[model samples]
Target: MRLVATPFQRRPAPAFAIAVFLAITAFANPASAATPTQTQPRASVMTVAAHSQIDTRISGLHTRLQITAAQEELWQKVAQVMRDNAGTMDSLRQARTSQANNMSAVDDLKSYGQIADAHADGIRKLTPAFQALYDSMSDVQKKNADLIFQTDHHHAAKKG
Candidate 1:
């Protein structure tokens, strides 16, 4: 038996082969290939990229919204508070990772819990600041702020 392809069919054969090759390359792999620890640096690089994207989006939103005097003042305060608390959050993450590294050797979980609890407390303390800033925003400023906040939150949520 002989199979003959018309011109139209002949044109698509190469494309079809390429598609199949791509499919095989994409899916022909072990299900559990890399462990989390092995990919931590990759994950961190992604986190940095996401943070960059969020910062760019925030800057764009701020420019588009043309924030008012009151909103600008409150946002500055919020930014300062966030800057101060960034170290606290990073330290908390490091403490958790350190605990993981020493899990079998250390019998004390209390200190780890305390570090986490303090991070939570810092966030709680910032609630008033966040609320005060949000409440003072004009309609346009609020919308822009919400968009920026939500986008950043979405990125953080995905990382978590």
Candidate 2:
């Protein structure tokens, strides 16, 4: 008997791969992982704290990219998507924290799936806006943007 992979099996493998990649990318950056801690009573409070950090990061990127007035609209779109993704993750985290004690293993996995889906959705929305901004960038700005978006492991290895 020959073993064969079904279409469903093949389909889920790529989706699972993407979910793993997004999970790693989302959690790898300390700044990006600004979801409310156990001590934080409200995600809103954590969001307020995170806003400044996000602004600082975005501002640095803006300067590095040397964004012009023409590119500001697309930049704002990308920035807004980043903010939305953070808020969605924070909300998901808060919901999971509140319900964790009552949730079954399957339920907990479902909650994680929701968070992962949100991360994927955020990337979907961000890509077009980011592509627009990237297309408008000068050669130097494009290089800076590439560096800014590169994985931490790659960046660190290069630096070291």
Best by lDDT: 2
* Tens-digit lDDT string for candidate 1 (16-99): 111111000000011132343431222133234334433454455456656567578765655444433433333333444444
lDDT of 1: 0.40
- 80 in model 1: Cα distance from truth in Å? 2.3
Model 2 residue runs over 4 Å out of place are 1-46, 151-160
Most TM-score-accurate candidate: 2
How big is the positional error of residue 1 in model 1, measured in Å on the Cα after superposition? 45
Clashing pairs in 2: none
Given candidate 1, what's the lDDT at residue 30?
Answer: 15
lDDT of 2 by residue, 58-116 (tens): 67667877899999998897776665555545555455555556665555455555555
Cα lDDT computed for each candidate against the true fold: 0.40, 0.52
Could you give me the TM-score of model 1 versus the true structure? 0.47
Q: Which stretches of candidate 1 lie over 4 Å from their true place?
A: 1-66, 94-112
